[model samples]
Target: MIETEAWVLYERSGGSESALDSDDFRRETFAFPGPAGDELLVEPLFGSWEGNMTHSLQRRPIDICKQRGERRVVIGNGSVLRVLRAGADVRGIHEGDVGILHGGHVQDEFGYTVLVQGYDAPGTVGVLAKRTKIAARNFLPLPLESHHRLEQWAAFSVRYLTAWSNYHLALGAYRLQVNEPLDPAPFVLGWGGGSTLAALDLARRAGCRAAMVSGSPQRLAELARMGIVGIDRRAFAGLEFDEGRYASDPEYHAAYRAAERAFLAAVHDWTGGRGAAIVFDYIGAPVFRASVKALGRQGVLATAGWLLGMQTTVNRAIECIGRHVHVHSHYIRRADSPKAMRYAEREGWMPQVSEIYSWEEIGGLARAAAAGRLRSYFPVYRVNPV
Candidate 1:
């Protein structure tokens, strides 16, 4: 057994509303019990949190683990895991190989244990093993040493996987499910995040048109450079809409609804007044409502996260009769990661990182992220060098 230290987050049982208040973290060294069977011992290299729903402990607004912690070891978008040691029986993995850590569960038939985190069992080193199966699989291998920054590989791991699954599995498959052919279609990408970038790339690959809505001018500019139509939601941050029917305060909810309307208008114009074939939404509530409204007949609206709040109020009438829109909860399956990686390798895809932090700065980064002061497109943490 090799001894090593890991920083872990401990969410106290039954506690406060704020994750920062209720949770505590510590660094502890424990033995790296050698892989039992097909297990592969891995050290996390680069990671970044989505800061949305899945990363939240008690539905906290911001994600704390993007900066630090080991819970849901494979949950982040750009989290990269390096194989440190491999069990004798392990195949398709080596000591120096790199792969993505995914949040999918291994089936009982596969005989691979899915380790969520070691937080539940103190003093025990949690080992998550990856294995190849006939059916569902999670781990995706990357190109060997050809990549420059480790952070780029990490971001490519999940964000692209998510975008691919959203378009291919969710929307494309949904179209097939309805006895329709999978074809290139217009897409409305809400919130210019990492996944949105990947979706744009997927749209380009599929020969589809895409428009984006974002508050960040930098992200908008980036999308524009890719020939994507972008609508700056910041402009509508103060516009009044519906006579303030959905108004919450002086310039909060009302402004948000106005932005949604503006985004929908842009989508309509971009799609030639036919709306979009698909709308990918990460920001919940009003954006979701807008996505539903902007969908053309038989369109699909796939959502993955709830950055604002999960509870949303959309027009029940449209859901009932106006449109045949399909609203799907988008979660990337284990099988989707490898497919996305294969496509990315062919296209030479990589994530754009805004900040890179050393493994040592995790604590301070977590504090800043908790305070909502951290501004980043993607924050990558380098744990160990190759």
Candidate 2:
């Protein structure tokens, strides 16, 4: 049978008022009592209660192993395993458990500790006992080391969990509140290489039945392979320029004006009478401004790249009042998750990789990317096979 314990570490004070009024003493205390406005009364000025609670609870696994005279104690879950590994004279738990600890067995407030029983599969660990109020189940009843490796592991784990949780929450907000079903399809203006594809994929996933517009036919063809319909702009023939006349000369000036007019006319014709629902602009500020002008009421222009340039001067007050179009900037930092990437690949949303290279090839790969010779559809990974 698996065993566990829970314990609370409280700071010592001389008298009743000493306990109640001494801020320094209360500051070290992990958990405290409160009533309404008194909720703010027992705030710990030193550290978090959750950290203290986790530190206190970790002792249970260690103590239980020692008392039972067992050479090793196995802690399931990555965080607990990391903690167990850091403590001296304790045998660290390995992943490969399957039994889950019943929820009601422990207090739900802190909701951290769980006892492992055994394994269900090769790598998966199982929980046996979970969420217990019994103090005896708590183990390793000692103060954590000042520069504890376990604390570092815990901090890193919490950081990732917090980021992932925030991302999901934002996605939830989009689904429930912000997102609306778009109709008549949207005209997506794509630029650059990688981010453009990503935006197109996102719009398609968001149920925007749209046609993508790209400067490169090669990129448009790549999108087409992914079942995304595209309008290729590279197909348009270039107008002949009157090179004999300078910009100061009337003929050259007239030619430049005609070119601008021709470009705007092409854009207007391509968009049809109804304005675009969304414009995925990654080009320069001039293109972005033009995209904003082309949007109908309630239309959105999402910019993911500023590689061409960033500074765009605008009469914001006038634009906001007249256009009623929303301009948003999207900066996506690639999530460092093998699981998420694998899922994307399995779902057929992410393109299959064509090659895997050694670390030595990284510089060459960068040059290839700069030269635009690389397809940019696949994720590149530098693997050390050794």
Candidate 3:
């Protein structure tokens, strides 16, 4: 006999005298002693339907158990009413709570019984809770190391969204099926600092190389610090542009075009005519066509934001047939996967956070993103330890 520390309550058919021999009465009749040595059992009652009897029994198991002086009670879904009626030593459990009703299945907010330890909120009866597995530990707060590990794991799992989003685009362009090994050479592109770094880290994990085209020197330097090889205007000759001169000259537009052509030529040479697997294309339309034109057999162009403008055209059918290129645009959502956090921690790719700000400084961070002054940037919320 598999003896367990739990109790059941139910009714029997016929009168009280006939109940003992009835199958329904025997099935509904069960008892167990509490840890404090109190015997508990369901009252002798009968009902027309099994469902109704089970429902009633769930609601009153605790009450019936308490009448027997059982303070330490374990109630199943059907016995909620009895537990509520007994109302003896009732205290909710938390995610990391140990002892008491540990390893037991309880209902959450949604009325689903799951193996959850924590109470999400007070006064939430019959509501199911999120399920989490727990290990043996004395009733106490999680250790600092454990807390930090959980935080980092949660962060990385949440931040991996950017990588998965980009990967989706690449997968579609390559006409690859799920579970198929991707040819990493034709599917990786490094764009903005965060996304680029995230993509590069993902590429490394996927066993592929990545190409980065940075508009700012600081960005290139940051990538270098992350051990990502990058190419910029400074690396090549005869492809320089004077920002001041271009801004003032009568033929500024013409000079800009010439400079763009030179830059494109350098890119083409760098790729050895095979073209890039992915292009960041942050400089917008001026370089948009060049980026598309520079794609390898199955390259994807993922744009985070259009800084220049959103107007661009391509011969859809021809572009698809000739270069087999895919275009994808996206912006990061606040909730990302924890893969990103893990990558940041594992690779030490921490964003060179320009400033740490309190909640009051949110406006400043917004202004910086608007003015495009933040470097390798991200806004972090400040919370008190308490």
Candidate 4:
């Protein structure tokens, strides 16, 4: 066994996010066994700072703090790794190869991800350590001749696959309603955090008119530089659809209606009055109402990210058939992994990073992400030397 130092989250922040500052995240020594049974001994290079990490730390929705009766876990979803040794049963991956590590731990019968490694899965350690031994199935080897930096690939790890899957599913749902070829490609509007930008990038590449709604002026400019329309999210400020507030507060109801009107008007103006054919939203509850209302007839609202809040009230009777709006929401499909990696490798679908934090400052990073103060859509952190 080799002694390794890993950042361990011993306690959860519970329901409140302010408790994230507690001394629960600290470094501890660990013993990692040699690779066996399709396992790989790998060294983490760069780890991605998921925007929703605070949700995991807070243990509010999904308590990844412990799994399979094991308390005190090291939680990480994505990282770039350098293979030190590969088990005899491993295929394709070999010693000394560098690759992006995966987190789709277990899939459903139809290849949909039911369990994610290093987050909610049992016995699956994350990539926030100096060294780790993991199953080879979680490894996706990067090309040695790749032009993008290792850290950029680290940005892609689970994120790009997620974005690609979300994008394809949303586009498919749009096709189901529109029933047309890609001749006059649809207008795709993406609004949310990290993964949304990457998905918008995919839309831009596929000959579709792409736009991004972001409160971050820096992000707006970044997407603008890439020729995507940048809609100011601040314009739709009072559009949150809170069930209790809308019911009790008259001002909230008025503000919500006004904001929804402004948002739909903006959407129509941007898309030449046709409205968005697809609105890829992942921010969840806060923007849910405006997003769904902004859709054109038969337009689809695709979502996967739940950074702000998870639960939202949607009326089934109000959203189908004659209403002509579809909500396509799901986690990443297992089939998206390899194909998404190929797109990243061949088409350079790397994320646009804003900040890269150190391992020691990871706790602070989580707080910043929750506060939405990060300058870039894609934020990352270094684990080990590249």
Candidate 5:
């Protein structure tokens, strides 16, 4: 067994709210049984964090390892790594090959993930460790002698793959209804997030008039410089409509209505009443309604995020039949996942990372992320020198 130095939390958090306050991370030694016949031993160059990992940090019983009665699990999902050694059965990829890992467990027929990975996958260690083993199929290699920086590849390793896959769906749906004869260049709008930014980048590159709504002026300005129209999210305040408050509190409903009116009016003024041909709203629940309603006739609304709040209430009758709005909801398709990293690399479309943390600062990264202190849409961290 090759001993690996990794950061681990012996105890899981009791609830979702205190993911940072409990179970402090400690760097310690653990046994790593090298690689299986179909697996490769990889050393990660960098890794990124995502919000979906609350299940592992919270120590939910539903976690894959917890269900199997395992207490210690390595935590990291998105990574850019180098293959140090491969099983004898592995082919095409050998020692010194560099690739990105998109994590998941039990891939379905379409190839996308049904269950999340990282701590969620059984017998798997994440990129946070000194070294880890992964199935050869999960590894996607960058093109030969790629000139992009390690940080750029690290940031793009995870998010851009999903973004490229999903935004392609949105554009295809939009083109189905609004074609070149009707509108050669349809307008696209996406709410703020790393995926949203990546999708918006594609939209702009595809010759669509693209815009992004974000609360951060820095983020908005950055995208704007890249030719994407930036809309301020703060203009429509108190618009996070909770299902519970919206049902009982008449005042909350009225306020939401007022914000909705202002938001739609802004959309009208901006688009000249054309409404967006494609509206991507990955930030589900709080802003789902506005995103759906902002769509024009025969427009496409794309969503997959559920970070802020999960339980959503939508006007099923009005949006579909009355407005002709189509909701394209899913992650990436199986066929779409394989070549996304190389595509993003070729296009030079990488997600922005405002900060990069060090190996010893994993705890600080968790606390800052949980507290909403991260200044960028995506932040990456170092795991190894290579």
Candidate 6:
């Protein structure tokens, strides 16, 4: 057994720790058994804490539905690494192979589970303790040209896949099967957060006019540079933009919903009275109602995350039955990594990484995420331990 240190999270006595101090994360050397079968020991190069990773580490209900036996490492997606050792049966990847690790865990109704690589440590190197049957699907090979941009590739891997799958496969496929051929006249509306940027890119590629809903001035400027329109979520909802008030005050929410008529009217005007063809929203309750209202006839709303809040008050009669709108829920899958990587290479697009840090800086990064202060579209960490 080889001993390597990794960061692990432990459940508290009663409720989970809400605030992130230095004590929440720990680095301990663990004994790892050598690969015996189809497994390949991979040393993660760079990783990022995106939606699931951030939520699992700092969001409320930190221990929601978690049992005593759950995995200690609270990581999710985005790992670009080199393979160290490979078992004889492993076919798709070999020693010294450079690839991105995908997914957190996959499970079926019968309890068959596959824990894809997680960003729990995000900085330290460790052996994959689980089985390796899923590696064939999860490991996506990166081209030699992308080696120098490991941080960029690591940051883009999961976000690109999530956005690509939601837009290209989920929303795009639905449109082709149901109504139109997804023509150039269609408008694509993307909500806030990391996935929105990628979805906007895909929408533009698909010959649609892509627009984003964001409140940050820097983000708006960035979007303009990319030739995408930016709609301030606060201005769109007719609410004075204040992140703190929006979170704590119920009146702002009610007012925001009341201003939906204005928002929908603007959407109609933007689309020449046709409304949007597709709306991408992973934020769940906060913007879901507006997403539903922003759609045109037979439009699709694609979703993956519910970070703001899960439960939303939706009037099914008007939103669904009346408009014939479709709600498609998709989770990131291992196969998406390769598809997105190929698309990125072909399109000459790379991830927008803002910063890179060593593994020890992960705690500070986590604290920033918890405080709602992380501004980088993607922040990645290198796994080099002293």
Candidate 3 C-alpha error for residue 367, in Å: 2.2
What does candidate 2 score on TM? 0.44
Q: Estimate each model's TM-score.
A: 0.77, 0.44, 0.49, 0.92, 0.92, 0.83
TM-score order of candidates, best first? 4, 5, 6, 1, 3, 2
lDDT of 4 at 304: 76
Which candidate number would show the highest lDDT if scored against the true structure?
A: 4
Deviation from native of the Cα of residue 367 in model 1, angstroms: 2.6
Which stretches of candidate 2 lie above 4 Å from their native place? Answer: 1-187, 235-271, 322-346, 355-357, 370-379
Give the distance in Å from residue 175's predicted Cα in candidate 5 to where it truly belongs.
2.2
CA lDDT of 250 in candidate 1? 55
Give the per-residue lDDT digits (tens) of candidate 1, residues 1-386: 65566554553444445545423644455444455566666776676655532334333643334333433221223356777667677677777777776644332444322322321212223221121111113446666665446677776655666677666644554465344344445554555366766776677666677777777777778878877777787766643233336554656665666677776677777787876767777666645666677777666777655555567666667765744455544446665466666666667766777788776776666666666656665666666665
Tell me the number of clashing residue pairs for each predicted model: 1, 19, 33, 0, 1, 2
lDDT of 5 by residue, 151-270 (tens): 777777656767787787777777777777889788888885787888888888988888888878888789778899888878888778787888999999999988888888888888
Give the per-residue lDDT of model 4 (tens digit) for 43-136.
9999887653556666657666644455667678778899998888888887888887767778778877777767777776778788987778
Query: All candidates' lDDT scores?
Result: 0.57, 0.35, 0.39, 0.76, 0.75, 0.64
Give the winner by TM-score.
4
Which run of 10 residues does model 3 get worst, by summed lDDT? 39-48
Q: Residues 164-208, candidate 2, lDDT per residue (tens digit)?
A: 223333333333423545342455444444445555665566455
For all predictions, the C-alpha RMSD in Å is 5.7, 20.1, 21.6, 2.3, 2.4, 4.7
